[model samples]
Target: MKQHITRFRLRSVSAVAALLFAAHTAWAVDPFTVRDIRVEGLQRVEPGTIFASLPFRIGDTYNDEKGSGAIRSLFALGLFKDVRLEVSGDVLTVIVEERPTVADVDFAGTKEFDKDTLKKAMRDVGLTEGRPFDKALADRAEQELKRQYINRSLYGAEVVTTVTPIERNRVNLTFTVSEGEPAKIKDIRIVGNSAFSESTLKGLFDLDTGGWLSWYTKSDRYSRAKLNADLETLRSYYLARGYLEFRVDSTQVAISPNKQDITITVNVTEGQRYVVSGVKLEGNYLGRDDEFKSLVKIRPGEPYNADQVAETTKAFTDYFSNFGFAFARVEAVPEVDRANNRVAFVLQADPARRAYVRRIMVSGNNRTRDEVIRREFRQFESSWYDGDKIKLSRDRVDRLGYFSEVNIDTQDVPGSPDQVDLVINVTEKPTGSLQVGAGFSSAEKIALTFGIKQENVFGSGNYLGLDINTSKYNRAIVLSTTNPYFTQDGISRTIDVYHRSTRPYQDQGGDYRLLTSGASMRFGVPFSETDTVFFGAGGERTEIKPGTNIPGAYLKYAEQVGYVTYSLPLTIGWSRDSRDSALVPNRGRYQRFNSELGVAGDARYVRGNYQFQQYVPLNKKFTLSFNTELGAGKGLGGRPFPIFKNFYSGGLGSVRGFDQGTLGPRDVTGSSIGGTKKFTLNTELTAPFPGAGNDRTLRLFAFVDVGNVFGENQPIRAGEMRVSTGVGLSWISPVGPLRLAFAQPVRKFAGDRIQKLQFQIGTSF
Candidate 1:
């Protein structure tokens, strides 16, 4: 029994012994004055640490109480595993066996997490290098590591800790892990649901049984967080469909004994559906009762919908906020009649108090400058709070494309009733990227392209980029920069310098090229909140090189305008974009118009182009989009239209199923020289990719393309357009937007080059 008790007491045996000694000394050994002190058995710890914690020092009176207190205090320090106190002729001696220091911490068989990450986690739990090592602490760390693996669905993962004592009382620790297969969700059952079928209800959840794309979507993995999110989605689905008293009563998750499969069962109660009988408002409206009533979205004749009620209350609160009431409260109180299965909504509003902003605070911007974000805000400090301006300010910051998240919060001032502070919280993201591409070929063998761009250079809210391409067919180097805030009023300025040497057309084998160099500056003026107008001018020289396989049209142009031609091109453009996303837009409209003129050059021409795009969402998974473009050019001062300035259309971007830039009139050598007038139309219907739930980055699109480039004198006629219809895939990849099309021409003339399949990156129609 004594041995059993000793084992059970474990590390506390020393404390128990010290207490017994103190009792004996009080009874038999009398207290003595300590004249000197000495410490022993310490390896790495300082002596002062022990001296400072002692209850009685040198020349001080010692007693049983002080002896007991000293033992307790030293034990609490955690640096020593054993401590003892002795008194010999008024000279006290302290002995301590110090705990071994942790010289190193390591892990084995970890694939899912980085070693440094695990070390940091161990450090948080008081187990790390340079710290005292204890068996209890190592056991706690082992448990924590197992918990981390369990969170990743590895239920069978095992962690074993190994400790090796080295020289100088230092120990090394290693956590060897055996990570097993992940637990997949084998079954998901929704019970107590009758209004909707089991399949329909399950369809709303992101987690499910195994599917073809399970590996990519990971929807079959059992995650507590994902389960909770799915449960919320299920609740919302029923709430939106007029289930007034619906709720989830219980959820149960079970894992198989092998730890490779999981089963989930959810019990829910779907209450009676109700229809709205009437809607009323019952609160202060600040003398704008009519306007406040207009914000109501509830329809008396329709079914009761929680979404409409939430929208109405949110609108009411925003309306009150617009009048400087920062602490406004609005709610929709539902009156349900069980007998008739009907409900009525009463909107209650309270405009608490009017307040103005005392100061504006910004945070979470580790790299971006404060001025970069402040200039985007329209709501100023020491002014009345306006919801419209605040919302606009958030949108503007988001549109900067430099931040991943932008948020604003209103905080009340302390001891002040009519003042508040606006806090702007921003999360920064990588605002720069470098892309390099290389390939091997014969003519353009060893092709390489290196491009780099920084949208927020040094946190100054400026854009800088460099593009370099080296290939036999096309080679160019360009530098560009933009200052978003050139002046105090938000006008932007951009500069561009480029030198190019390339064969812009595919004519079998061509050592021929066009050498061009130029520089330009542009200024953009914001015409409105959604529109911007730009105007710029530049001077460039175009030199045609004579080589084997060169086109006859180029030779003719060179003879007429000499081998070298210089032009000062004047440009103006305007754009209006309201799209929700630039890469994948589901609902919005975009319009742009640009025109250029070669005013003082041997090659005198005026060119204009216009584009219009509209996207309409037909349903949750389908979108209908249309694109239209038109171009026209004319010669000035009786000079013929410059052959170098032409529009080419075909292949992936326009009129797929035809060769790229091969739809226009061909020269005598059977080579495409392009055309001066062009028109194209694209109609597409996009849908969700199969087995990939809720991933908008990948999608399937069926498009019909119709367009053709016309000669300088040819009229732009719809009947002459080449048309094709096909299906394709679009993915927003890390490199860029990738598009692959498989098309077949529906309307085509003989001698038209046919290319049934095409692939491209960063081309949009």
Candidate 2:
């Protein structure tokens, strides 16, 4: 009986201990239905937002797991700095400390960037007005400002952030930035290089030590990006010279204690010179090995050239892409023979799959119409992918003068390996301009010009312009418009109405005038992508006003054909322009041929002019251009060409050495009497402004000009042509395009007039 009692007691104790454990577990994770939910400490955020973020709702089971998840969801909103949950009975309460809102953002002592720009930058990083503000974000903003200064080589720049608490639980951030003087490269040294001289290697770098033009070029500025670019150039130089194992081991940029000067050191290892032992193909060549082999630029028994290898591979890839292989891959693998100091290149090509363009998409053209860009594309939707056609289409769009940037991206369909989409993205630029210009010349004194021009009028891909000029010598009023897609067959229509009165600027033919008023309509038919043919007709009424100092040519015309004359002129022209840039051309050719016939008028004559220009890039910094123009006019039937139609040379647009319109034959009063035949040739070498880096808006050029005008009976003679040589500056300033030249006549006659300096502002030639 005693043993049974003790066993019963032990069993009772075990049962009590197990019950306690179960009760503790139940208290820890007991699920209860939420009877009420309430949020506290909400200023800007809505209560509904908090309720939406909660993982548990009223009447939902609430446990430790759900409570933790609810806290996490609330914190992830990034609107609260502190979040806490409390439970009383079946009610759950959430308490949050909302982040301080940014009331305002301002900058002080920031001359490099404007306040609006800096604010925009901050806004981009989620630190804008009315947004959540915190120390972490403010710290990031400070770092971003520092980074911008560093990019400008401002090593000593300092930024201080001041957070001022304002009303309504908001804070205003003030970034006080002090941009220090940019660190200039005082010295650049290359060590451990033996194959090339230090000076020779240094010439390959775009960055350099301080020079006379350093202030403008900023090449002396110490920038991490520029240093990396220079290092890559050095690598390319060595690699292209057959240094197969060349490498830039280390580069050290040290700044002075004052942070105003910097020194760069580059250490390199050029292992050995290599020769190309052989070249071979290792993959399928679309069953045209010979054709593919012909594209290889690498030659056996020649020094190994990395450029050649890259070119050969790129050529293979492009060739494959031309044949509908949109995802082609071509890689050149080199097998090095260390003992022989030679390498063999094996080109591997993979034509992954044939694909066609499923659709051509255009985007980012906010102002321009979709059809305007589509019309320029040579590659159509559903066509086989052709790399050449795609490139041409991109170029055509770039030449439209409507966009600042044009890019083409090919996207492959997820489920269709044989289908792709071409996305043409364009960044639109301002195509309209209102120009008001005033320029002074020695002869014309001061000339004022005003014009309003719109190349893409209202996104319709049309052109409209109105010009008014008030100059003593030349005055004009004109209106013009063009429809680029007149007939939808790529033919353009242009209409122009103009009235002008001309008098000699230098001779001041006091009150004497040749008035010309006319209207014309023209159509430009595209013969090819780069060629166009234009034909038009117009009627002109010319009047010779008699007065003191009248030009002898005009007097003679008035005596023969009366003071007033009318003519119906027919015009036809052809032009081909493939220049890389319309404003600052650096390559390609521009050729034009234009002719005018006075078929039914008081004056019967035919006039024709031909001009050609070619630009060749000599190097990264220099461009060589050549221009030639020829014009001739003759009487038709038995009548002489109108004196008003005479060609005038010797000006900024012609021969720059002599006075404006003062070249060729002269009358008794020593006034220029322009002739019917004209020819001119201009050659120029253009380069970026000293210290201007790669800015093409400002440039300097040295030119050689030769031209002369001849009478109807005079013969064309090289000896009779005037020659000039000078240096000039071309600047595309905010006002307009300006050109200034100081020319010296190299060849001239005793009767020739000289004007050494000439300039034109707000003009296009």
Candidate 3:
């Protein structure tokens, strides 16, 4: 009975174990179906975001592989820090900890860069205010800030970032930067240089020791770009002086242990000096071999001059381009014989194709219209390219004074071997000004002057000017207009109207005033690129007012003629101006001759004036200029000297150290005298400041001036003229040219001299 009961209990236990094991296997193997998905610990992310991120959806089979993929997808959004997946029966749950959103960004102790610039820099690295904050991005922002500071030579700068959590699942970031002392160049050294002195080479660098202007130009700051430029300058200097194989082998910049001092070392290799032994030309002559030969400026047996070689090559290329060979290539192949230290050049020319201008485009002229620039071009579209005409067109644009920069570019047309396009770019600048000022002198206590002028009206290259001056000694009004291009052939037209009054200079003597009004029209015909001939005609009326203190000679003339007048006059003039600047010439010549012949007038008269000026640049820093003027006037038809035609000299524009219009013939009361003939000479030497950079705008000048006035009856004598010597400063400021001078009368007649110091504003010497 015991055995049978034990066997039944064992069978019951086995059945219960089998049922439990079967139930466990069924629960594990049954396919899990998700009825809904729940997300928790999400503040910034929406519930739909997690649903969209899940790999498994409702009614889909849920497996371990799909659940792991869902967690990874949620984390990949970068908006969540922690993601988890849970399963309960047929329901799936997703939990996510969203990253904190950036609330605000703050910077502390930032003077090197503006707030906006820093914000931009931060945003570029994904650390903006509204984006989700991350540790890696914040660290990257800190590193970028430090790098920027280092670029500015602040090698000792420090940057720290702080992240603070705020309400509404947001955080604030603050970047604290400490900009330390900037590294300075303690010394610079050159190695393997024997052709030139180290000091001479150092002088060519724009990066130098600190100077007064270093704060503005920041030349004391070190930069890789500046170093490269300095290296190029060094190479150019050597190559220009016959050093054919000059090169900078390597450059090294060393910083001190304290990060406060830097030393630059440049290793250069200066090879043998080369002398030209011979030159040969091989190219199509275009039936002008003699002309091409004449264009070769590089001479054999002279030191190899890179400039002359380049000029010869360019001349050959230009000659070809003028004949529609736009793709011509002229290569100057130098054959160097190292043993003999001699070089030979072969000018090889290739005329690839004869190309025509397919299109003419104008750009970069924001203010000037396209038509204005196109009208000035000598080269036209749909025509054979002419390099000479294109160069001339560029020069004309440069001379307009309305553009600061001008350039021309050419591009080949696609699929068209014989076609090219030309583009012209220009940068426009202000060309109009209004001036109102007053001048003080012993003769004229205060002379008020007003003037308005526009060199380029509406970017049309036309000129208009109005001038008015009122003073006790002189008064005048003038209106003038000039059209630089009145015709397609480069002829200009000018119209002028003027009313002028002049008072005779007298010291407590007789006073005299004359009034004259006239209008003139002139036509300027181009004789050459740099020369012009002008013809004009005008009519004028003159009335003379006699004063009580007239000279005895003048009184006799005044009794004979109460007033003198002229009805009409004709004028002819020729001018050539090739100077770089009209006010202060640097390198060129200016010549002008004008003559007025009486046609039909009450007081028949003839007057002529001739002026010549030349400027020669002695070197990069020194220039010498010479000026000469001659004037003559004669009264015809038995008329006494027309008092209005007399000449007076003094002051800044003439012989300095004397009052204006006070250096000529004087009345009985020791007033200034007027003459019918005038002669003057002026010379100046200009030099740049020592130790300054290659800025030619500021300079010092030494000058000598000699001038005098003589009557028609009197002969011109060199002894009668007054002379002055002086020194002056010239600056090309943004406002205009400013000049200040101090002069001493070297040849002063008794009781005729005034102050020794003379100065003028808005004038150039």
Candidate 4:
């Protein structure tokens, strides 16, 4: 049978509708064996693409069902704008109109986002250059552009897409965007919060109506994600304070007609506050009930705290998993007494069948090597699942600083309840940094410094660093490298080479100079997860040239040890850090001890130093910190402590009000000659910067500093110690930690050089 106008056009189309139309007998053709197959309207799409989509091949039988299937399959590819099939005397011809290829994508009038950002958003919706163009795709692109603006509180933004057809069946697309004023949060109201004042409850939220720092924090911007998070915070605040049944009933966000202002209202119910009556444990505890009981954190007669309940349950589950019960269940079921306003908790635990790790897999390491990450894992394949070891392994990987995220997933083996697989997933990040800085001062004229470091060299977990400093008074070039995992057991090896030349601190040229050149090798042995001991040996050569204004102590030492001296120094150091955070530490302690011995050298001596730091969080917005450093040196084998190795004090890191390296014994010419013994104490009270709210990156601190350096033969005394108190600003800037201090010395000797104001980069105290 033959039919006229056999083609069926499709638009805003559905494959099912096309299929049903072709299946009708009135529009279908009789079944026949195909003699040949051909594809039409192919500009860039290959002929094989059409052949692959057809249900039946050349010389194959053709029927109504086969033709319908063929048409649906071709349309689903999205490569064609229209498709039709014709059958004449057993020869099947597939005809299609290809969608126009986008020649270019351009954006205009977009000020908030970069042009490339908008293009990427368009590409995400399949409307970029070289892709097929259609009206639906254009509409999607416009919607995506508007969504991007909406996320930034630009609800009034508009988008217009223009398509221009060019030669060769291609089109040039342009998206014009208009971003209006951002919607500012004008008011926030808490409808029903009584236990705590509305101001107190609203203070817990990061979002606010407006503030002086709003331009920087953008806390006045309205976002659904932020609102949801703030609501969760509000809920948690009440739950922790014994409000057991607190809930948010509704949240309303209202916008002005002009779309420039928004108002938010949250309705909440603050339930009755209850105190904990008792805590009881139920279910199996693996016969270690005594050990498990010690993990309970709930305190009877105290207010009910959801944090404590959660901690107790998680502790039980982790303990069970530590004993190979990987699938453990733990819950805190509460019994509430409404009349007495008291609650009791029953912790239920279940230890399922023990599971063993059948295999361990690692993935998502595109740039890093497998061995680099595998060596950090403590959990092994074919071993009983130990949750403690797995958590330690994850922490060790995170400490490597190579990955931004690390997760360990446990999967049960099919048909085997006792076997599981562990998959370690890692997300890699850049581990290299380059720092450049320049400073001007009266002593150093124009100083410049550059440093480059790579913590994960070639993804082998090695460290390579270079430092260069150019200044009038001091110049140095240093090169260093370290292999953190030099041995299978995690012993580290470091090698360093450096050359330094120092002159007296002055703006003009100096006749005297001190040149030092050396190389060293160090080995670090980890004593524990938080402690490491390092030992090294170095060979150094020091040359001293005599001229005017040189320190008298230096001349005396050089006369005894000669103008040139060579020394072989042996170094030993130990450090332990349990700080919770490296920046803006709230609570923690750090200690370091180092000793240097000139075992075999022309100028033999011994020196040792110790440092301690402690941070105590006073509250959410304030911290009390203390730092103390002590140093003492002595002569060994009848030789004095090397004058060049003397310690200096009274600077930004020490007594801030005094001049840099100026608080010690002075020569006849009044130049500071550093001392062989040093003692300094620093105390600071840190709080959030004014107007910044809870932003931790910027803070203000008030500090008190006491102590000074002592000469080799002088006895240390409290009367001689200089004292200063001041306020300062601490910012975690892009370059480094910066501290600016304004100090006034309350106790100082007449000869002391008072700086009054000083600042430095890259030091905390």
Candidate 5:
């Protein structure tokens, strides 16, 4: 016969007295052997759990001491609400009240966090579906929800949890959260500063009182983490300016009684400025002291700058690592003379030992193949560790554009002092995109573009793309593919097939179209890590459609060429790019030389273009960029250069502040017949958008542009070039890269067409 009895804690006065009486009376009766152990009141826990928790077995002796220990052990499991042991005729009966099971967790009024996110967070802290539920755990969950909102600057947020008992030993939990408005920073004040003005010091901080752009930057909101970072910036500003003894004494953050406003006050000590006296080397340098000394970035007579000191130390450490000293240590010991206001530094170095790489491991590349990444590594396994090559390998993998993050870590092999393992980790990003977009312009009204590209198809380092543009005036279709490892020797092969139709005067007059179709195959041979040479051949047929608005130059050409032309184009090009970032590059040099020769078919001509671009970072927030392009073409074998192959320069991609493709010689009826020679120069000063909190996605650029196209018979003249100065904005938004510019032409001829505003979206600059 089975009997069920739920356990109840000995909390009542009578129950406690009875437990004491039983304990006192237990000495009167001799300890008896346990015949059998029976467990009751268990719903979810197995009987074996109780058997394993009990101190006495069925064949062992049972006493009050054993019963107490058994109860304590069962209660410690946290799976039971109450546990008790009772003895009746030597058969010990164990009773347990199982904790209520969580049937379903629900949330109400929670807008900031996803429902599943909250459920998962609770699961991590021992509260989940079908898990034991307790009042203490529920209280902790409520506090955790509030803490999340608090971190987001919602000081007045509240979370209330309700537990409702249900049938089948289950309880439903509901967490209702009221996320209030974020607290705003009302005021920021700096005190105890004599070297710099309050405004100047406050300008160095990211957190501040609300500004016109605060809604976007969120700097007006109070965030402890952001505040901490700003404090560090303030300290660095002083340290870099020769205040070697600067100290941030205290910071006070106050919140209003309503919890809607915050105020911050910073106290700092700006000690006397100092100058560097000298620098010396101290510790063992492996006999390369002179080589290491040349790497110092500090000047002896310069003001004592902490940044320079830190840079000098880091350079020393990196130089040591380049010689297989992976565990090198370098420290800058400063000797300060307060009376003379000068500081001297003694660089101490310790090259612990030399090591070689034992194994090369790659991880975190879920989509990209291993070979695609390994081929970029110049450092080989089982070779002496070369820090410079390892860094280069890491950068090469990062430049592939398939990974968002790439990291190299050296791990010491166990029991091997002179051996280490190199681990390369990469986090993959989405490599395929299907983009469809439409933009509006006063001239075209609406232009639609579509593109589908896969940079790493099926985890192979290959590229396939299709492009289609459907603008009433310009329409085209292109299919292209590239195999980055064409011959498994780092050479790349690309094939392209394209059909295009262009109307030169559709915006002004009738639709006179030029239709062209062609295909090309190119191979890129990498001469160096940063340089490539491309050579290819292509065939094309061009047809000129009859129309009233056709330019005089085109009409004359069509009559001689019979309204059709054919050409076999040979192309050779070389390019070198060392840009730190393809988007928003701060420092780099990019140059390209391209030549096209029409060798076979109805046209014989040669055209070449050379372009160079350089970017220099003037400071942390500003970059100076310069670009120049030159193009020239001439007929060969007594045949004129193809009219459709002429070069054009103006507008957004060239000299702005003028009508697109209108800077060259004009044909009869005032149509821009593109010329055979093109030249352009562009310069820009770019910086992050103001009040954007270091977000590189948005930037502002001021530029100067100069260029013009020259006809086939016209001599290149610098006096005829157009010049413009303008300001532009570049934003890398979720949709695409968007550019907008406002320009004014400084010099223009009487007949020059002027366009002051230009914009384009859905393209990378």
Candidate 6:
């Protein structure tokens, strides 16, 4: 019985011990304070990095809350894929598996884009190399690649990206792009263009079907910008005519299945054409009704010219604006009588509240100072805004040549409807030019020249020029300056000092040169909106260099010619041009009449020249221009004709079929003869280059020139004139204007024939 009780007690004790062990196992988790955290399966990450990511520190409790937070933070860093926390006794360990970093990015078969450009595009979307690799970024890069291709008209381009994992926890990305064919213009059709023929209307579009000159003009390429510009041209063409209500309804651009061909269709609405019956003005004319009425160019019983109407409205507004009416309005109310198909315009003017300018701000001049541009303004701060003066200021700034572009913008002052601030923006260009040229002519066999000129000296809009020419026929040194506005009231001033020597146009056994040195000052004052009067006086000294070439008559008068003479000249001129470029005037009228009277000089004379040039557009393929110049020189006070002022005509500027300065009367040895009076008439029919399409920069022209020089008192006769007609090619090059003409003499006298081919550089028409 004793043995049984002992065994039972031992069994009970054993069972109790077993129960205690099970309880401990269920209740006791290893109490741990995170001593450190370690990361595994990482080639680029450090152990301390993993520890730094833990939320609980070495002596802190590591429970599910802290452990879970540590793991969540590690995963949020995007540097790991797997994260876990383990506790052993009083130590905790944090483990993480790091993601791969991008090693390098490359492009394959990408000829359309540069490597750096693709890299920049990818970088914009977080796909740059050395950043963590993500599948989303790679997909975005592919889309961006395709978008860039579309901008270049490669609509069918394809892009693919590949991510390759390499050793050392790094990845490499590759973008493969296939740039398909470029979209080309297959057809461009215009509808509802009845006023102009289809061929004529189609010629206005810059984007066109493939032509032989497509390589140069690139007109066969489809571009959205080009289509929009073509629409504007169409509108302008119609408005310039009588169609004032023309509109572009829609434009459709369709691409083919292959995405290599495109078709464009333009739909327009043609409106009724109207003629002007009469134009009447109703406004507060400021007691100058008659003066304002004369400014109206829209006459009675004439075609309704949109240009004329706009001009009339502008004139009225300008007059009011000049009187401090900053907010002026001029409306052209057209009264149409359909029965007679005539329109009468009543120009209604309203001069809204008048106010002075608060301030003038200058902008867009990155290289120029504010004062440089502000000085050109005619309308000052705290002064009334004059539209006419403002327009004149803009023109003055444009003529400076320092600015590539000049514009004036008016902004209304906040809370003041009648007040405005003017802002002048100018873009600066290279203002200094160095010109060096060498030419060979019959008169000046080998001539070399150099010129240094600055149109806008230091952005001041003042001119300084120095020119030197050395040749067998002539030599000169000139220093000149011009201030477009010397006075505050828009008066211009010019100063010149020059020394010139000219060899007489003679073939006889005589050498004659004239040495002339002079200083002149001219002041230009506005006489009207389109006219200016220039008056000046200067002193000149002429020293006749005696040589064997001197004519007998000139030598007889040379004894009294070597004297310092004081002379005054007065000139009045008018100009009105609406061409986009002054150097190559296309459609404009230029007229001028200049008269110079030599008062109180050794040789008294009066010289006058009247010139008129008109440009007419016959069709899309042709532009006809005509120029006429009539000049007369009369001796005053019983003085003989000045031999130094004789006129010589020929060469590229006059008759191309003749030599330079060799077209007039000649000596017995076939040399040029100079005269005192001249007359010339020139006409040209300009066309596009054969294979150059309608490139405005290159043109071909057929011209006819008729002119001659006569004695001072001789009668003008058509029989005594020389006529030449020829075909010429011209180009506006970066170096300047270049021309080459192949001419034939239609009518020639003895010793009048010259080289059939003539070429010139730096010449403008």
What TM-score, over all chains together, does every model reach? 0.91, 0.90, 0.74, 0.94, 0.89, 0.66
- Write one digit per residue (lDDT tens) for candidate 5, span 1-765: 233221122211122333455467533334689998888898878898888887778899866666656776887888888776666666667767899999999999988789998888788777889888999999888877887788778889988898999997899999988888889999999999988899988877778787677888788988889889989999989989889999999999999999999999999999989999999999989998899889998789999888898899888878887889889999999899999999999998999999999999999988789999999899999899988889889988988899989999999999999999999999999999998988675345588989999999998989999999888677999999999889878889999999999866223677788999999999999998888999999999999988877888888877766688899999999999988777778899899999999999887899999999899999777899999999999989987777888888777878888877777988878888889999999999988788775667789999999999999999989899999999999898777787778899998899888889987664333
Q: Between candidates 3 and 4, which one is better according to TM-score? A: 4
Superposed model 3: Cα runs more than 4 Å off: 1-188, 210-229, 252-264, 283-290, 435-450, 468-477, 487-489, 499-518, 539-567, 598-603, 657-661
What tens digits encode model 3's per-residue C-alpha lDDT throughout 1-765? 888665434322121233344235332324578787776687767788888887778989876556556766777888977776545556666666788999999999889899899899988888897798889989899999998887788888898888889899999999898888888777789899998999999888877766675565566677778889999889888887888888899999998999888899999999999999998888776777888889998788887888898899899989999999988998999999999999999988887899999998988887776777887788989999999988988888788788888898989999999999998888888889998987764456688999999998887878999999997767999999999789977788999999998766555644667788989899999888788899888888777666666555555665666466666888899999888888657799889999887768675678899999899999766899988888899987887656666777777767776766678776565766578898888888998644345556667889898998887878999988899898877777665676667788899888775766665555544
For each candidate in turn, give its C-alpha RMSD to the true structure in angstroms.
Answer: 4.7, 6.8, 10.2, 3.2, 4.0, 11.2
How well does candidate 6 score on lDDT at residue 187? 86
| Candidate 4: pairs in clash | none
Predicted candidate 2 versus true structure: per-residue lDDT over 1-765, tens digit per residue: 888665434322121233343235433445689999988899999999999988878989987666666667877888888776666667777878998899889899988777887787787778888889889999999988888788888989999999999888899989998898888888899998998999988877778886677776688888888889889888988888899899989989899999999999999998999999999998889999999999999989988888898889889988998899989998899999999999998898889999999999999998899999999888989899999899999998888889999999999899998999999999999999997878776556688889999999999899999999888788999999999889979899999999999875446456878899999999999998779999999999999888887767777777777899899999999999888877788999999999999999897899999999999999777999999999999988888788878888986888987898888877777778788999999999998887666668789999999999999999989989999999999999776688888899999999788899888875434
Write out the backbone clash pairs for model 5: none
RMSD of 2: 6.8
* Model 1 spans with C-alpha error above 4 angstroms: 1-78, 83-97, 439-447
Better of 1 and 3 by TM-score: 1
Give all candidates' CA lDDT scores.
0.87, 0.86, 0.80, 0.86, 0.85, 0.75
Order the numbered candidates by lDDT, best leading: 1, 4, 2, 5, 3, 6
Question: Mind giving the per-residue lDDT tens digits that candidate 6 earns over 1-765?
Answer: 888665434322121233343235433334456565444466777766776877767678665545546666777777776665444445454555677889999999888789999889889988877787777678888998888887777888888788888988888999888887778888888888888897888878777786787777777877787778888888878876777678999998999998999988999997887788888878766677887898897878767777788888888777788788877788999998877778899988777788778888888887666766777678888887888788888986776667888998988999987688998888888878998988664445687899999887766667899999988878999999988769877688989999998875444445677788888887878766556777776667766676665655555556555433434544444445444466776787877777777777686778877778888888766889888888777767887656667777777777667776666655544555577788888899999886566677889999999988887667888998888999998898776788888888888887665667887766554
Off by more than 4 A, model 4: 1-28, 115-120, 437-446, 503-511
lDDT measured at residue 385 in model 1 versus the true structure, 0 to 100: 90
